[model samples]
Target: MLCLYNFIRTTGTLKKQPVYVWMWFTGFIFFLITYLESYLWLIPYFRNNIVNDLTIQWKSYGSMVGSWNMLIYGCGIYLMDKISGTQTYSYSKTGFAIYFLGLFNLMFNWGHHIYTVPTHGYIKHVSYLVSMTELLLLGRIIFLWRRQMKQNKKHIHQPGFRFYAAADFWIFLTLVLAIAMSIPAINVYTHGTHITVAHTMGATIGINTFLLLAVVFDQLNPLIRKIKNFHRYLLPGFRICNISLFIFWISLIVAGIMKAWWQVHRPEVPFSTMMISLRPYFMMFMITGVTLTAGMWMMLLPVVKQYFMHGMHAKKRMELLYKKRNASLSTY
Candidate 1:
């Protein structure tokens, strides 16, 4: 209780972007459904019920959350639309690609939930393909983004702590992402479990961290510039978290991949058996990351917004984006 009170106090006002509000609402809905399925749903359904009912319930909730997650995909489209309508400082094609790919990865993650559910047959197979498609989409997005950036040979090339910090994150995200995807290929030959878990952590959960890191670093530019020798002072912390993000992304991707493959190959194994296998890794990539990452985000965004939203620079940018764009439209 005290902790919650302190959290709320220190966190201060969390500015609710339209997208952020929708995410909270959807997240709460998903949590409620998860709680019911994991706890309350069992008792009522098990009243002279069989495993079939459980599978049905699982599918139902999976569908529910999956739908909510899909709505987030719609939010990505919203982001896309906003970016397109503006001419000033739009996401580079590369940024747009990464943004879209993030959406693709999330879609499959939802599919993965349904795939593991029992009695989920043809539907599961379809979901698997879609999920795999998500992976391919993500891989392509990253690949293309980098390649196009190289071809275009354009960047602001600014010298600042935030610049270096952002560079560190992207570098880490790229390197770990490569290793994460390769773990499955390596496992096919050597069949090592240790590497496999590391892969999942990197891919799924780590990607989440990287995404958040990118958002934070991008938004932190104003704050970063305000500090003295911000780059030098920030490097140690940036390196530490970037490394953590890299590893976590590695662990998550590997974990999600290995778990999926193991389930497909060994359906007879109790689901709990496989899930238990993941619990330890999940502790690092899932629980701990979620706690710190979400808390930090919910806490820090307020401060960042204060910094980001202030001054003539922001007003100029907003005027360029919304006002100028709208004014031009009127002239047209």
Candidate 2:
């Protein structure tokens, strides 16, 4: 609510703000609605009905998740514009159309999550179409954005720019997985498997995490520069995290494929047996997860420590000034 209020105050009116601003505002509004909708299952009136069951399934699966994606994507667009020194408030008509379509997609895309559930055929078809359209539109936007960048201004904030680039790569990778999973035929096998987990993790860690780190590094640019030998950690950490994440992602996909194959061809096999078969992939991803964690801490720890140290120094200065003022008053 406070965020919405501040956003509205800053933008003043939606008509004047850029397309990304609208995306962010819509995200904030819809996120609240979907979050509340998630809890509707707790209400007696909404419980024990086909409609409510479908609603819960959809909400649990993707609607709220999509809302937050909107917020992150919006921020990403804004950052891209800022970093490239292309703060053009003007948007093409196609951009506006895509934005509106994205709003519609966010509302209806939840249907894909309910495919296994008994529901209208139109719901599934519409969702599949909408999801594809959104991905294509996003790809187009990224293509255009990349083309618009005339020169690398990355020297201004190298870490931030590199993280943003990493996010773009991950977006492409995750979109491939997302598009594949959206296919009803493919979804049948992958829906509840680790493929779904892979898709979510790719989006969360690959795209969202990198984009957020870009923002964080941009904000901490000065502090980062002040820290001695920061590059030692940053360079290795960045490489390690990306490499580990790629391995982790592939491991999940391999496990999901194996699991799905077993389920389809060897339905008579017990769940424990199938899991035993997946143990190698599980071990591979687990080790990579640890490496990923270590990489993140290496990159983040120095900046965080510097930030708190600066804060403490500022507090001490204020305290000394206060004490001096008190002594001056006493002299008078």
Candidate 3:
């Protein structure tokens, strides 16, 4: 938030970076829907309803948010055409591969969100099928990307950042998350506790946490800091966030295990409440209020902004300031 304010204070054309614009638009929609769901779920109105009712509402609003997000996100990625050879796309083939993968991913999400509607049974089945299929395709995309990165024996970069080593981490996490999410019959095989919560946390930590860490590592490269000659202070910022996410994931994992083990607890209460009622040692801070939320937000805050705004706003402002100074000097 502070960074955004400072960025806006300076002056420059933000340009027609459609990818940046779409990313921010998607993120803005994400924030709004998340905010609404968080508040709405807490209210008593939807509490007593069947899972289907809650699911329906979620799907309705989620579809609205996601459809527009897809359009903008696709536009942004397409706009990357100008940055083909640069760090933005790495190479033409690599960039197209990524763009297609992203396009398909959005379509899959759209299908999945609409699948379970009460009006259509066949639509639901098709949606379910595509969801898992997209997961496998996503896994393959990561694999190909990693292969390309290795075969090239080189990496891409931008000013103030040049660490492609983190791409490996990104690919690995995406695979892990895809596998975890694609598990069929998970709900039926589960002994107790809702299958959804565990799946949600697993994806959140497995994918979200790793992606955040990858960005931080790409920026800081602490593992090879001695040889890299980068600023040492940035290491602490990345480290703090990485450790925070690790702890959060570990805590969520432990809580899930306990929930599965203690089958007698009622599902009416929130997961946080149930985890606290378990009274497990690890569950103390991990399952409670603020900790998980703060950790997840910490990871997301930077990645979300970086993707959407890309710190490029600050750069744009700096360029404008430089141009203004040059113009003033010319007056003499």
Candidate 4:
């Protein structure tokens, strides 16, 4: 709300603002609506019935997630424009079309999530199409942005740029998985399994976390510059994190596939026996998860400590200034 208010106040009118601003405004509006819609299950009138159940589920899974993804995409685009030193709005038609498509997807993309629900056939078809298109558009935007980056600017915030690159890779990988799962026949096997978990983890940690990290590193460029051999320290953790994440992701997908296969073809098998058979994958998943956490902490701790020291020095300077000001006032 504060962001929306400030944006409107600063821009005066929405017409002149860039595409990202519009995307953010749309995100904020729909996020509020969908977030509120998620709570409708609490009301007696909205509970138990198939219509309300589907509404709540779709709002929770689709628009709620889509809303935040829109916000993040806006931020990601703005970051790319800043880094590449290009006027994204110069390509206004493309930008606006992306915004429109995102909006359409936000509204209708929940269908794939609720595939198991006996909703209208059109809903699933529309969602599957829109979701694929949305992913492709996002991937294309990032690809073009990366291609357009000047060699000189590439070195400006190298660490941050690397994170953005990682996000692009993850977006492509996740898109492939998303496309496969969106197919009705494929979704029957993948939905409600570890594959769904893999999808969630990829989006949350891979895309969202990497994008946010880019912003963080970009903001801390001054401090980063002060540290000698920063990349040397960072590289190990970076490699470990990405490699572990990939392994972890793959393990989940394999586990999901095995579970799905057994459930369909070996229904006579006991759940315990199936779980026992899946032990190795689950063990790998847990180990990789731990390593991923360790890798992130290794990268984050030094940056956090630097920020803390900077804050303390800033506080001391302010204290000294206050003391000098009091002394001057006394003399006067």
The C-alpha RMSD of each candidate to the native structure, in angstroms, is 13.4, 2.3, 9.8, 2.5
lDDT of 3 by residue, 164-255 (tens): 23323433554454344334343223323333444454444444444444445444333323332233433444344445544554454455
Q: Evaluate model 4: give its TM-score.
A: 0.91
lDDT against the true structure, per candidate, is: 0.48, 0.83, 0.46, 0.83
Ordered list by TM-score, greatest first: 2, 4, 3, 1
Please, what is the TM-score per model? 0.44, 0.92, 0.48, 0.91
Task: Please estimate how well model 2 matches the true structure, expressed as its whole-model Cα lDDT.
Answer: 0.83
Model 3 poorest 10 in a row by lDDT: 158-167
* TM accuracy, model 1: 0.44
lDDT of 4: 0.83
Ten-residue stretch with the least lDDT total in model 1: 155-164
lDDT of 3 at 29: 48
Per-residue C-alpha lDDT of model 1 across residues 1-332, encoded as one tens digit per residue:
35335534664654532333334344444545554655544566454465555555555555454444434333433433332354322234644454445344433333333333355466555545544544555455466676545533433222222332343345445444433433333335323344444443443333334444444454455664565554453445444555556556556555666676775578788878888887767677765465446544543445465575566687888778998788889997
238-273 per-residue lDDT for model 2 (tens digits): 999999999999999999999999888889999999
Best by TM-score: 2
Clashes per model (N, Cα, C within 3 A) = 22, 0, 2, 0
**Higher-TM-score candidate among 2 and 4?**
2
lDDT of 2 at 64: 75
Tens-digit lDDT track of model 4 for 1-332: 78768867876877777788787788888888888888888787878687757757675757888889888888887877877789755347888887888788889877888778876767778888877786666568467765545543655447788778788789878878887888889999988889989999998999999999988888898888776678776888888999999999999999999999988888999999999999999999999999999989878888888888889999999999999999999998
